[model samples]
Target chain A: MFESADLTILAGLLSRYLVVLQAQQALLNSCTHFYQLEPRLARWLLMTADRAYSADLYLPLILSVQQRTYNTADLYILRSLQVAGCSVHWQAANDKRKFF
Target chain B: MIKENFFEQNHLLREFPQDVQQRLFPLLELISLPLGKVLYESGDPSNFVYFPTDAIVSLLYVMESGASAQISMVGNDGVVGVSLFMGGESTTSRAVVQCAGSAYRLNGQRLKDEFNRHGMLLFLMLRYTQSLITQMAQTAVCNRHHSIDQQLCRWLLLSNDRMPGNDLHITQELIANMLGVRREGVTDAAGRLQRDGVIEYSRGKISILNRPQLEVLCCECYAVVRTETERLLPWVFQKGCTVKTTEASMSAAKAD
Candidate 1:
């Protein structure tokens, strides 16, 4: 439990974090329009890893891939990322996790 | 020179305080904007600010590869070339006429002078700019999260809100460019809407048949922009409603 003054300071820090996150998102959104898909995907993955504080990402790809058949393009992009030194491990049916 | 009453058609000009109207009106030039006309390219100096009476202007951010995506749109309810008073002489985005119609344009210097007056116009312009920023931010969010189908619904509703009628004279190719998606994606999404009887598309025209249904189909981004716009510029929407009521009564009187 935080004291009243401490809580106010924490709230202020959280709001500042939100503002920075929103600004970064807006910048990324515009930059994605200009940049190539490979670099953009790498940047996104790096950011995701940084935010999560973990190098490994467990993505449920099969379910989403089946729903959107067009994700073949996404798969190809991911493959390129793997070739670019980002290790990708695809798990089996029972354990639906794609580690990147 | 346009008639004095014509200014009222532009929500921004219509709601201007009486003194500001007097000072600003004479400087305005009524110009016809043709479809696909580029108002300004990226990094080009803004010479004039446009107050669209019936036209819609799309602010597009273009890439080095020539691909472009619309960041936001401006219609009668707001002004274009906001960078003039925002203290930026040039903008990175290009402004293009999305719909061909007439608009009143004021020289950028005159606008700056009025803004420097530190009066109602300053507050109004700041509020309008805030709403425009909200729209741009929401567009970024929508592009990342929403499906093409939901985006089309939001786009149609937003465009329809700006115009006086249901018809939108734009092609799927143009919309595809604006949304930064493939033409086939827009075609597929539009086909679904047409089959649902929410809209009718033929040639380059799309007529919205059910607005409520369109709203239902749209994502939350549309509502977010709308609420922000209404909150920032209450007089614009409120005065528009009152004007519509007055026009209805006038028509009824003529019939009687």
Candidate 2:
């Protein structure tokens, strides 16, 4: 589902947001499957990717396994993003789309 | 015999040519791999090759952001540091103790010296490496294609195969972390399995209640890896449930 363009965009997004080249690449390298993420997951990571230097922004998407439920940890990240004034749009792949 | 006592406890070490076995036994340092202990990290120099007698070590890739996922698992059927022999002085994955138990470790230099002789040990290690490769590749495929529920079954089966008992001391969160999935997904799947009596999960421990039912729920990936492992390492056996020991069984070789 991800591509090099997405990676370039992700790296650009992360680097520009974090402003640390070393940290950017390090986070990218650590997240082995960084570009192969669903759009929603990528956006979620990008939103939180700027919180300090803990740039595990692409982590949620790196593991090839698919998981559907949004647990407390997932909620915590989304909640953190919302509290920071970033409106979060969370959706599970199987859930029906809401117009709101 | 005192020095060689535990060699029999490890299938790989036991199958070694007597001359090679004699050379390695004294050098082997029997040690305990406590659960969650990080043995090596990505790009770290491996100083020793660990031969797990009962413990299971997971090879995981940790992201710079601290997220980690397992790539493969090593047990008594294999060695821990294949990158040492595969010409990479450092590995790209982290080795962690999954099922804490005993293992025999040999200094990397000594292993290299022994492997340089181009004998049965080297041949066996190479064969074992092939099986490890299959497992790593299969894990990648499984992670990419299988559902979290199916992956859990595979993980449980693989861990169960390495362990000496039916119970596993791991949490859904850890399993989710290893599978690179959401904890909620694991929680749900484990709950379903628990409800069906396939397993009993509580207090971060999962006990396999019905082995046959668990097998019925797993994907084909489990069988493929198990079969390939036995094919590559002819000595790898269908282990029966036994008491897991924390103490190093260095004297177990005497029984062989």
Q: Which candidate's lDDT is highest?
A: 1
Candidate 1's C-alpha lDDT? Answer: 0.74
Query: Which DockQ-derived CAPRI band holds candidate 1?
Result: incorrect
Candidate 1: chain B TM-score equals 0.92
Candidate 2 deviant stretches above 4 angstroms: A1-34, A37-100, B1-5, B238-243, B246-256
TM-score of the A chain in model 1: 0.53
Candidate 1 scores an fnat of 0.10
Q: What is the C-alpha lDDT profile of model 1 across B178-198, one tens digit per residue?
A: 888999999999999999999
**lDDT digits (tens) for residues A1-100 of candidate 1:** 8776685455445434543443354455566555655466557656767878567554445454333223433643334433333222223333332333
TM per candidate comes to: 0.73, 0.69
Model 1, position B90: C-alpha lDDT score = 73
